[model samples]
Target: MTTTVRVLESSEEDVRRGPEIIIHENKYEFCRYNLKISRFINANLGFSAHVWDAGVALCRYFEKEKINFTGKKVIELGSGTGIVGILAALLGGYVTMTDKPKVLKQIETNVSINIPSVCRHRVNIRPLMWGENHTNFNPAYDFILGSDIVYSSVVYPALIETLRYLADQGATIYLSSELRKSNGSPDFHNNLLPHYFNCQVVDRIEGKDVVVYKMTKIATTSEEDPLPSKE
Candidate 1:
């Protein structure tokens, strides 16, 4: 039998330097699972820990098909709460987990606690701000990940630009979002025509909403055979 610790409803688990935690006891053991995470990677998903759990569930949608993420260059943008992206790292993606400069350390802390095994060597930390022109973008990510990043109409232009810039020639962009009443999807679709990003609704699960997108460097009208990056 293993020991278990009851999680405090609210604790002074600092959110800045170390991973803020909510220890929960299960049948066998107690674990200091981190919570209250906000921002990992670059895209801005307005975050609430409870709400972000929905996004984490969505990230695992691809696993149902048994597609291995091992040894893939993956980036989780707008990693608000960092849970999804950290999970990706644990699964074996050479994950570059970035976010805003202010919250980069926080993102680092969360990953370290949940997946200390891979954070330093595999999961890299960096700063990626949306709407800003970034020349130091990685061109080798097999998949770009985001969770619930669609927030407001004001941020649509920046978000779209950021997504386009980081995406490689043939990269799969997996996003998890709930179609909320006041989400930014409307504004995003409005600008997608003039720009080019082959977006598609691949999966929509009950508890989690999954949208798979394909992006390319050049513009093409050929919609039938958009070169898929990976499954």
Candidate 2:
């Protein structure tokens, strides 16, 4: 099968035209913990400005599992609109949301709008590029998260390296990705990731074709061969 592209709009707008805003109000369990997320979409911002199914699925999985994030040190990678990190903050985690330098503003806007004043201190937004020096971020995070980040084969090596660098001995990693071949290949989860980390499927959103995986670094021996190139 082949992928198809549709022109959903009449014509692409100029990058300088600014973003088109869309508000998403998400609530869980008896109207508690309402999160008003603002998604900025336009030609300039690319897919980083929009919410993907993987993000939504991860948010739902968090709610369903009722994971204890209270007082936990957490960081989210590729936090497009900061949805997962915001939700983590709402659940009492000290969360850092990160993405490319360009999209930090959008994540910051969403973080400010959703996180309550008293809890705002728990959330921090930062710029991160995979495979780059991340010395600014501590390696003691209790949890590392990503949604739809495994969207390209080109990023696998860097992504894995970053994960290995950030994760401490006991840190847990959660990643969610859509199963669509057009969006990304499954080989990252099925083949490459397992070599670096012990991976297991923790949640599957029915009908969404999205799966959430839990991972921890595999213990390495000095005699073990180096990881194969993901290029």
Clashes of each: 8, 0
The C-alpha stretches of model 1 lying farther than 4 A from their native spots are: 1-54, 187-195, 207-231
Error of 1 at 222 (Å): 17
If scored against the real structure, what TM-score would every candidate get? 0.67, 0.84
For residue 218, model 2's alpha carbon misses the true position, in angstroms, by 0.6
Candidate 2 Cα outliers beyond 4 Å, as residue runs: 1-31, 182-184, 221-225, 228-231
lDDT of 1 by residue, 1-231 (tens): 111122334343433332543322111111223433433323232352332433543444544444556889888787645666776776777888767776665577566666766345888878887766445786677888877777665666677656666664567777655555467464454344225576655555454333433344444543742332222
Pairs that collide in candidate 1 are 37-81, 38-81, 39-80, 39-81, 40-79, 41-98, 42-78, 43-78
Model 2, poorest ten-residue lDDT window? 1-10
Backbone steric clashes in candidate 2, count: 0
- Candidate 1 lands at a TM-score of 0.67
* Clashing residue pairs found in predicted model 2: none
Model 2 lDDT at residue 114: 82
Per-residue lDDT of 101 in model 1: 76
